[model samples]
Target: MHSDVPILLINLDRSKQRLQSATEQLNQWRLPFTRISAVDGKSLDENTVKRVFDEDNARCRYPYDLTIGEIGCYLSHVKCWQYIVDHKLDFAVILEDDLCLNADTPKVLDQLRKITTEWDYIKLASPYKFRPYHIVEQLTQSNPTISLVRYRQKIPSGTVAQVISYRGAQRLLQQRPPFFRPIDVDIQWQHELTLDTFGLLPYIADNADAPSEIQQLATRKALKQRRWVKLKELLRFKLKI
Candidate 1:
């Protein structure tokens, strides 16, 4: 693993427009990243409807066959895992294509690295939703985890840029369950179960209607419904923890 971390951008070949926009943004910001397309291994030309159904069915089998969403999540995790094994990198950052970073990203990342060194369970650095009452001003070690600064309002849940430690990456690869619904939520739940999940204040902004099916679905659901869902998830996660 190289000491220098490379940002992995998950994308699909069909989303040429969004991909191009993301590429342009990265160039404009001069951020280094590796782009990988998430295509169904069975057939690249599969129709959009079929791809959607396959993804909904979660028909992501091994030996190359993969659903659309599975392809994205799998490739993202695989690339990170392979990088860790090959280069022995301590950690790396991962992001979807729909978000942009703030000007202080480099400095924030530096702080993230320092926090990771002090905590084993610091799996992700979420740059979205600045919630109140979740702040951990300085690096203070909790019994099982290290706490970081959090915002004072409720943070909206979704994919943003995140930095993952080597241990976190290994945990992801090792803890594959039978069903992986909402891959982001699954990983977040896993972190919650371990009580090692940390949030970063002041999100990097998730572009509206930016080519994300999951986000669209979540948007359609009522805010109250979303809150209830989160509450239920928390209860379920508490049992696991």
Candidate 2:
């Protein structure tokens, strides 16, 4: 049953090539999926923007103003979460369009279906390098190679691929909207989202490393770095006193 789990593929309307790549990969695995027309930050309607995004909150909470591309990407994931709730699905696999599937993915996904661990969210792909994590449960009695784990120190980032339960979807949606952080960052702040999150080891998908469709200007990058500098200076001053 991995095939039983619904897969939601987030693809922008203009990213036909990415859509094609994802479709081919899923077809190869014989895993069916539904395509979500991603929210395009380039041309957001005023009303929809007002309804979904909170600029003031984002500016206050996040280090820098979010690029429209980041906002659109976050909204795209939100669409998948909403789908899980509306359909009353028990669980769903959400995949971005730019992931390369591993041959072991299907087998790992099937084992995940049989595991007994109580989980709200599980990451299938992590952007960060390996960090300390404790194994939570062995996926199968026979194969000791794959297991579920909880991060001990640093939480991994990226929304490349993940599994979300119906309860998880509900908790995420419960956020009193006008969401502030990027989707990945918001998920990492489980203290706020309040979900029992975990990661599947070893990762079953990798980024395709294509030129990102989400565009951020140089100014935005510099602004984020500048915030870190200020924080570092504050830390230094505290150390002196």
Candidate 3:
């Protein structure tokens, strides 16, 4: 019942099933959320693409140009950041539709509000495989243990769940249009934006088993490639030329 910041849920309009599933999960935790209509890759217009995405930068930094789905996903998070700035919110917990929340999530979020330190961004989830983390300190001495952790080597993958402050949102937004990296990758490289990033230990949110829309779209496209394309790849690998 004690939440200092609004919870923003990013969901695509076409993903009714994901929205419903995420809704039920949040309700179970008694957490009210504002829905953010996720941007769909398939519907992106030329103007938006040119205005928001930087093809040259993307090719320079990433191995491949970002897919339509990646571009849409990046824009969706940008919308949430814009919302925080426009609405004048102090902070917000942004959740992707595929994230799963546990019982301790609400309490941890409450504890986050009480902390007086200069933390800007706090991650609430990580990939299934565990990674080495530097624990800065525990949130409280009370039950439902959770701690603030700093990443020494790698920032966790996926923007499935995270808490961002007004300042943090503004800093991220300052990067502005013509974004190159994927949203998650962009967050991992947050140092370039001068963000004090951290993650929560005993992560409260996890990725659900539901298939990823982006990956599915990528796979389908790959399957539809010409046979010659597959033959060329196979020949290159076998011949080792």
Give the TM-score of each candidate. Answer: 0.62, 0.87, 0.86
User: Candidate 2 — which residues are off by over 4 angstroms?
Assistant: 141-144, 214-241
Which residue window of length 10 is worst by lDDT in model 1? Answer: 57-66
Give a tens-digit lDDT track for model 1, residues 1-241: 1235566676656667767777776666566777755533334245633533344334221112233455345444555555655666676666666666555444444455555323323323344443354665454343223346443322334554665666666665555433334444555454443424455433433543454631232332332233554566556556754
Q: How accurate locally is residue 107 in candidate 2, as Cα lDDT from 0 to 100?
A: 75
Residue-by-residue lDDT tens digits, candidate 3, 1-241: 5755699999988888999999999898888999999888899999989999988866545544567888888888889999999999888999999878888887787777766667778888985556578878777777767688888755787878998889999998988567876787677666567888888767888888875663234633343334554465345434533
RMSD of each: 7.9, 4.0, 6.7
After best superposition, candidate 1 residue 149: deviation in angstroms?
Answer: 3.4
The digit string of per-residue lDDT tens for model 2 on 123-218 reads: 988765666789998776555378899987446777788999999999888883578767777776775678899988778887787744633322
**Model 3 worst lDDT run, 10 consecutive residues:** 214-223
Rank candidates by TM-score, best first: 2, 3, 1
Q: What are the Cα lDDT values of the candidates?
A: 0.49, 0.78, 0.78
In model 2, how large is the Cα lDDT of residue 36?
86
After superposition, the stretches of candidate 1 with alpha carbons farther than 4 Å from their true spots are 1-3, 39-75, 116-133, 137-147, 150-156, 191-195, 213-234, 238-241
Total backbone clashes of candidate 2, pairs 3 or more residues apart or in separate chains: 0
